[model samples]
Target: MFMSRLRRRMGRLAAGVLALAALEGTCTALAQQMPAMPVTVANPVSRKITESIEFTGRFQAWPQVNITSRVTGYLDKSSFVEGSLVKEGDVLFSIDPRPFQAAVDQAAAQVKITQTRIDLTKANLARAEALKKTGNVTDATYQANLQAYQEAAASIDSASAALATAKLDLNYATITAPISGRITRQLVSRGNLVVANSTSPLVSIVAVDPIYFYFDLDEASYLAYQRASKRKMDAGDAEPALKAEIGLSDEKALSHQGTLDYLAPQVDAQTGTVTARAKVANADGFLTSGLFGRIRITIGEPYEALVVPDVAVGQSSQGRYVIVVGADKIANIRPVELGPKFGSFRVIKSGLKPEDQVLINGQMRARPGGEVVPQPTKLDVPETLVPDPN
Candidate 1:
């Protein structure tokens, strides 16, 4: 009877242990099947947006002048400070005046001497005329006196002209600024001999207060711009009325605004591009010549476009893409076409629908063909891409 009881107890314990093990196995299986990862998603914001194009360009001074001496002489002194603002008619440099003054004096003395000679000849001619009336002078003597008088008159005129020329030379000895602008350092210092009409410049001046920005537009873009403006190359308007903006190398926003004032008459065959120019105001003298900048111009009319934050876009070996969640709560990869950036938002050309939910956050945890718990949200879109003045 004891052996039978022990056997029954062992069997009951074995069955109970098997049942416990099965219960634990079922719990482990349930734990392995986890819920979907949560992610933040939002529908793309649709709005009327004007497309803009950007190109690398440089700042240029429209009226740059190279200062040079008009008369050959030793440079006496420079009147203006280097790198200083100068106005029209301001004395820039002065050549030695001693030689010019001496020339003027000599010309004036020559004029006086010619006048004295003319006076003496006039007296002699009067005497000859009186002698001729009295039959005391021959015809040849009278003719000779008249000729002398005429020669003296001619000599006086020549001397007077020489005096005027000398005065002009003296005036040119003092060099003056031709235009109002910022002047560069003096290349020819004081006491240096400078030749007239030389290619070497004494200094250079550039107008900064209405600077110019120059860039090149590809042939295709040139055609598109012409069509958008409704103006052809043969049109009477040389400058299109398009507006342009510029951003410096270290800048993000194109804060400098200007008008498209110049365009090349023909496309360059070698470069396949057309040169374009803009005029921008530089009241503070911030824009400088030869500085590399980025120029932006609106290409076409405003159209409706879907946009999302730039962070939402992802890059892959193929190209740019975005993760979108569908109705079934599954993440899918959608290839995207990108346009210019508007502040922090990026324009999506295609491959995205207005109603599709794009993953903006927790992108790392999301994968294509994976289940996700999407948290719906909205994007803050700006009315205009322009930065606030404040």
Candidate 2:
């Protein structure tokens, strides 16, 4: 019985020793991980910010006109050399005038013949009137002669008008440009017959000094702007009108500046977008018609915001989150409210404090309440920046 009691006492002593050793190992491991990690962080400071929207579109001239011939004949001459500057009233083409000239001459000869007939009738009426006075001619004969003379005079007037119309037709054979512009390639060459109402246009003229750009914005953008403006009014904040800038993606800012000319009244039902146009001056003709371009629009100013590097942020079934090392060196995951992404940084709307030593490095493999040894590193700088206010 005494030997049995001795064995029991030894067993209890051995169990106690093993438990104490485990406690010591855990304490030592935790002590090795505690240190202030060397990290570069940015403050959630106040400054002016802008919400920008970008889109692609094509450039086109404001006014483009097509030049066509009104009257048709053989194109005898192309007054405008193909691809040359022409002014208003500049003679552009000439048709063969022989045919129209012959027409004018024939009408003139007819008018002369009518004049001779009228002169003869007037003399005959005078002779008839003298005979009537002597009673040698009947009153009926005298009345007939006077009527014939009046009729002949009417014929001469009608013939003279016909001759004038023929001359006008001859003038039309020579064509002139209606407007001052750069002429396009001649559609008809010399010796090509042109009908008075031909289906084809002789050439085209486009005014290229001022150009327009067409772009589109979605409904979400429109709604966002409206909400932003309403918020300012409710809070009695200074509401500023929005502005925009434009550039070719490959090129720098356009030298000439202009304004947003129009916004469509209703959304485009087919695409669920609102069409907008910007007018850009091109007096130098640098911006050609039908060229591609992009517009960077500044919609609103930035509000106060807190942000963190995108690399440090993590996502799960619970949405975006980050591991925050508490003051006691305990790691805890906190849910964060995130706003728009600005380059490599994410705007933290809420749920994170500025003083938090956010474990940016090794976040992909870390967990909450687990032992964390921080290895500090450089923060990423955003390449594209929002508009900064002075």
By summed lDDT, which 10 consecutive residues of candidate 2 come out lowest? Answer: 39-48
Candidate 1 residue runs with Cα over 4 Å from true position: 1-46, 119-137, 231-239, 303-379, 386-390
Return the clash pairs for model 1, or none: none
TM-score, cand. 1: 0.69
In model 2, the clashing pairs are: 49-302
Off by over 4 Å in 2: 1-28, 31-33, 81-91, 96-182, 222-244, 252-258, 262-270, 300-390
> Largest lDDT belongs to which candidate?
1
Candidate 1 local lDDT, residue 285? 85
Q: What's the TM for model 2? A: 0.58
For model 2, how does the per-residue alpha-carbon lDDT over 266-302 read when each residue is reduced to its tens digit?
A: 9889999988777877665667677888775655556
lDDT for model 2: 0.72
lDDT of 1 by residue, 276-297 (tens): 9989999878888999998888
